[model samples]
Target: MIKECCNKIDNNKVLLSMAIKKKRYEALVQVYHSELYRFAYWLCHDPTIAEDLVQETFLRAWRSLESLQDDKAAKPWLLTILRRENARRFERKQFDYADVENNTLEDNKSVTLDDEMEQTVIHRQINKLSPEYREPLLLQVVMGCSGEEIADILELNKNTVMTRLYRARNQLKEALTDNHEPIKGALN
Candidate 1:
């Protein structure tokens, strides 16, 4: 009788632990899903692939949630997972590079035609940036990550991240200037 009682108590404890984990996972998803999706979209330039990458990233995060010691570290942690998941895509299979012009720009929010055209031009200029500068800039501008967080996600020193961000802004400015577009605080 005592052994059976102990077994029941142990089972209840395990169930309670799982419930806590589930709540934590759900909160994490709710808080970071949109940010993760936007970052992934910019990285791949494809909505479907971006959604896949975010799903895979969250799956990996759920599997390894126990290892994540700090709640404050969640953004950087999830971003790192997403970056790795994106890398794994190449390992799984090579995808034919699609021309940027072929892919339509999608935005849910309503904006004027001029606003949309400006966004398209800015996106094109950003795409022209080399990966090194582009990655840091996107993490900062798109993901709103700090220098430390960007460095942690990219596995680089903070100085390197800052340098890349500066260079990225300069390149983007130059590109827009060449196109005779006024710099309308896009980098800001």
Candidate 2:
């Protein structure tokens, strides 16, 4: 009888632990899902692929949640996971190429046609930047990561991250100027 009662207590403990873990995981998903999806979409330029990447990233995060020590580190942690998931896509299979022009732009806000055109131009310019420059800029601008967080996610020193960001801004400014699409205070 004592053995059976001890077994029941142990089972209850296990259940309680699982319930806590599930709650934590759900909270994380709610907080970070949209940011992760935006970052993924910019990285791949494909909505479908971005959605898949976010799903895969969250799946991996769920599997390895116990390894994450700090809750404050969650954004950078999730970003790193997402970057790896994006990399894995190349290893798994070659994806069919899609024309960037053909992909539909999804905008929730009401903006004028001129504003939309300007945004398209800016996006194209951003996409033209090399990955080394582009990735840092995206992390900073899109993901809203700080210099330290960007460095941590990219596995680079903070100085290196800042330098890349500087160069990226310069390059983007020059591209916009060359294209005659002067977006005032765009980089600021």
Q: lDDT scores for all predictions?
A: 0.91, 0.91
lDDT of 2: 0.91
Instruction: Write down the worst ten-residue block by lDDT for model 1.
Output: 97-106
Quality of model 1 by C-alpha lDDT: 0.91
lDDT (C-alpha) at residue 5 in model 1: 100
Misplaced by over 4 Å in model 2 are: 96-98, 102-105
Candidate No. with top TM-score: 2
* Per-residue alpha-carbon lDDT of candidate 2 for residues 38-153, written as tens digits (9 for 90 to 100): 99988888888899999999999999999989999999999999999999998998766555443335778887877877777888888889999999999999999999999999
Alpha-carbon RMSD of each model: 1.8, 1.7
- TM for candidate 1 is 0.92
Off by over 4 Å in 1: 100-108
What TM-score goes with each of the models? Answer: 0.92, 0.93
